[model samples]
Target: MTKDSVAAVLERLSRLYPKNIDLSLDRMFELLKKLGNPQDDLPPVIHIAGTNGKGSTLAFIRAFLEKSGKSAHVYTSPHLVKFNERIVIGGKQISDKQLLDCLLQVEDANDGAPLTFFEATTAAAFLAFSAYPADFVLLETGMGGRLDATNVVKKTVLTLIASLSMDHEDFLGHTLAQIAAEKAAIFKKGAVALSQKQLPEAQKVLETYANDRGVTLKSEGKDWKIFISKEGFYFNDTLFPHPALKGVHQYANAALAIAAVKELNSKWLANVTDSQIAAGLIDVVWPGRMQPLKDFPLPEGWELWADGGHNPGAAKALADFLPEWNDKPLHIVCGMLTTKDSENFLKQLAPFADSIHTVPVLNALHPGRSPADLAKIAESSGFRNIKIEDNISHALADLTAGRYAPGRILICGSLYLLGDFFSSNKGVKNDRQ
Candidate 1:
């Protein structure tokens, strides 16, 4: 159980930097130098970079490897409930004592130098992983890959790129090709790279980057592909178990993870069999991405679901899956960060939802779009019935009391918003979690 130690460290770290994202590797490299470069001492690492699906793909890789009897140290960013969720040591969340001690050590090593929150926490994770025994390290880039703090590692055995789209346009370039180029920077000269299926424009940019870097990239739809059926998923004619993730898009993400495991030339996985990969298909758990809420305080007649997909591509993916909910009324309680394209995101979901209730996300990192602002955005996107609520409890109360049949409810937008849901409704399983 985590205590005030975790909270106190996070508060101090956040105060070290004014802004959240300052994308560069110099600070991370300097800190690692002072700490004797723990990143170089870790086991073989699988670096993952993309706009979306990176986290789920990393989860699949961990599940696949762990099922094959390999221990892994996994790192991801933008925690849902607690900061501890970002760092997984030896297949478990770092203990409260372990996390706080590592953070304090890194903080002291910094000696009043400037480091972003992500950079500092990631250093702590690397240090912990280096000291511990693990066969692999699964690292996910926090944002755009080229200058992400996590990219400072000295050795990355394999790199995987998931689906890319226009996100973080302010930091990364505005165009899809530019964003693809930035993600491709995660590819090192001696490391192997595997990419998910990309749009033609994005694919062209990645191809150029690969050729320029003199690295060969094995991409989906070429080097490998998957055939999805109701029974299970087939990769290269060998069938694996069904993907436990909620969205149909998960089939594609699972295929990429499977491809990486199959393609990696590592002694650690030299004896891994197909049956382990099949078992791993049903083992991975990534919350807030099309996760269903089981025991939240809802009326007996209603069903609730939550997803933390915040970008236009994520919105498109959510729109594609929401249709399968079938026949029943689907109402959405949505909140979004001010940095997101709210109108375009709601434009995709507007056609499916019976009504949309806008709420402000309670996080201050990025002040969320006000409910009034979000309501107008929803209204412009062909949403006929739009309501603004101050908080999620009132939204749920009004929704339950309103004139509607037995139906499903979707709470979406930022992961911070979903974090609020998790905090308010504790002890509820976010399905497969």
Candidate 2:
């Protein structure tokens, strides 16, 4: 099959199966068995699972490994522009021909068993990684870690859990402990587990789980810690360069990646030079998490920032970074899926936003909170200046027309929303388009 044809076939397969995310490992395991267990053939794996910051952490790891002249394969989810963005081999995205070939191979192996879009794509990634020669493979969980398809991997050199927050409540659970427990399921026996600084309840839950499973638990601030200063950050006993990714919360995420690599201490690549770690931290880039789009349809000196933060914990982290605005009025363009906590998310915006503009995300799978409904939520959350626009373009137009300030424009809420925004701005039609 040709590259376009391969993509078309995968698209068709995605549409054929229901997109509703079923939280279970049975289907993926069965599918992998039929494919001759390709996942077991992957290189030294670094399995990262969390509600937020997982993608950034993976990016950091990839950047550092590449700096050290090591080849790394990465698999992430919910591509911003193209499906090919999800799979990378040897630090490069899979070519069209390679993607098509992998897809065809997986389709032929499936033998008529139904698989979700994510499941099929993951299978294709593992197949590609197994076929290729690389130094390491970084895997990020799609949803809840415990039952996530990526969890089937038996042995991981290291596992890092980033900030755990309340998200996907209907599928994962309602409370924080419940969500933490699900994420902690990624911990494998004898594998080193490095956890970011979590809440008291979540920390206790993860520690207990790791101990019970005989996994060595390295909780942030106890086993290791990151100290951020005006100059940079100190990881463990070493004072390393600051992270390339913006935001104060990123320091912790970068430290987690470094700790994971340090724990591995591969004899083949022993003694990771400080220069490699520094270069990796500086060069790493993860889109849609505080990504700045400098050249948008906005006036000069007007800034636009996009993030995929949707829950209360993510909002609080964003709020902590807001003080750097230096009193510049922030114009927020926000949209969210119906399953999210709209009220809680909006309330966190009160401190940073000068005015809130709400809009419906285009082509979202789940029902989205209408601009009007989100405006109501914003008002009730003590945000007095609230406006509802049909979509992002109109919202930006109105914000630019009004009395402006030397401030940034924040576009946030849902990852799907951010993907749509990027597609619209870049003139590329994605799955949603």
Candidate 3:
């Protein structure tokens, strides 16, 4: 019998449990127990959770750690192109052989018992992280933090919370405070918690939780502030180099990472100098969030970019950054999952776009809203001159044929669509940051 590839093994393991997301730690704990509870042996954890900016924040933190001569084992979810992108040991993606071996071991430990795909994969990541030697494990919650598969860590060195907004309404609660409560569960006693500026309601929830748990919570604006300028941003009066990642929002993300690093400098993560933090800011790369597509063929003066942001909060971030591109008229090419609030998401972007091109998220795991449906949503969201296309390539071809002024083209919305864009477009490297 031939050995199964990583893809085949992942597909088989996915069938061992229900398809829908059942946010609970029961199955995860059970599997870890069978595997001798590798979660307990992991290096000091920096658990992160929130609606958006989790990946970008984690990327910034990893960059800081690497710059300080530290190696970290990191785990994030929803790989854009390959499954291996989700797991990194010592700042490198998990090799296929090691990933397959870990998955097989996790499969054996499960003995065909019930488990979600994320739970099984997360278990494999923990096992691998435990075996490997690293200074810290930077863990991003798969979904809501309270019952997320990665929340199995009993104690963490610190908990980082990024921007919070309405997302995953079904699994996480609908209200902002409820969602904040769910994510704030990651704050452990004796661990410092840091958060980005949040809505008043969400802020109250997080503050209440932190106070009850006796965790010191430092929030943006209240505790630490980032002052942006034409040259660069300042974190709590300490000026830092501009981040390599695009957009003004990144300054806040970098500040959050810097704050976490400073909070840990005295104990778990020492020797992270100001110079190292500045270097990390300049070198950090978090692809698919307003990343330019330099390799794709384009007419002279025409620019192409992509962002994997499906929620209104992400859309607002993109909207805030769009004004900086006033030199060129911006045209948006968007594809979204059916589960997303397409109208709300488009509403945030509608004001800035000269035209909106709607397409289906071809590579999404679940069904995507039809192009026509998305266009209708865009229209309702106050966008005019909306066009429906088969996919991204067709959208670009249409844009080229239109001979519109050499404006900017932004492929926005679902991460799965971004994955499809990367897969179809040759020379586009999906570099894991």
Q: Judging by lDDT against the true structure, name the best candidate.
A: 3
Encode model 2's per-residue lDDT on 1-433: one tens digit a residue.
Answer: 2445765868666764645656677888887887889999999888999988888888888887878778889999877767788899998888878888878777777765667777888988998999999988999999888888899887587888999999898888989999999999999886788999999999999999998999988878998878887878998778888786778888988999888777766433535677889888877888878877776757766888888888887898788888888656888899998889988988988867888999997766579988988899999987888889888888888888856665678999988888888777774222211
Clash number for each model:
0, 0, 0
Model 1 segments more than 4 A misplaced:
1-4, 18-22, 265-270, 430-433
Q: Which stretches of candidate 2 lie over 4 Å from their true place?
A: 1-7, 16-22, 266-270, 427-433
Q: Could you tell me the lDDT of residue 319 within candidate 3?
A: 83
Instruction: Give all TM-scores, in the order shown.
Output: 0.96, 0.93, 0.97
| Pairs of residues clashing in candidate 1 | none
Higher-ranked by TM-score: 2 or 3:
3
How does candidate 2 fare on TM-score?
A: 0.93
Please report, in order, the local distance difference test score of every candidate based on alpha carbons.
0.86, 0.83, 0.89
The digit string of per-residue lDDT tens for model 3 on 339-428 reads: 999989999888888999999888566799999999998999999989999989999988877568888999998999998888887588
Better of 1 and 2 by TM-score: 1
Q: Per-residue lDDT tens digits of candidate 1, residues 63-108? A: 8888888888999977888778888998988887888888988888
Best by TM-score: 3
**lDDT for 134 (candidate 2):** 92
> What lDDT does candidate 3 reach at residue 83?
88
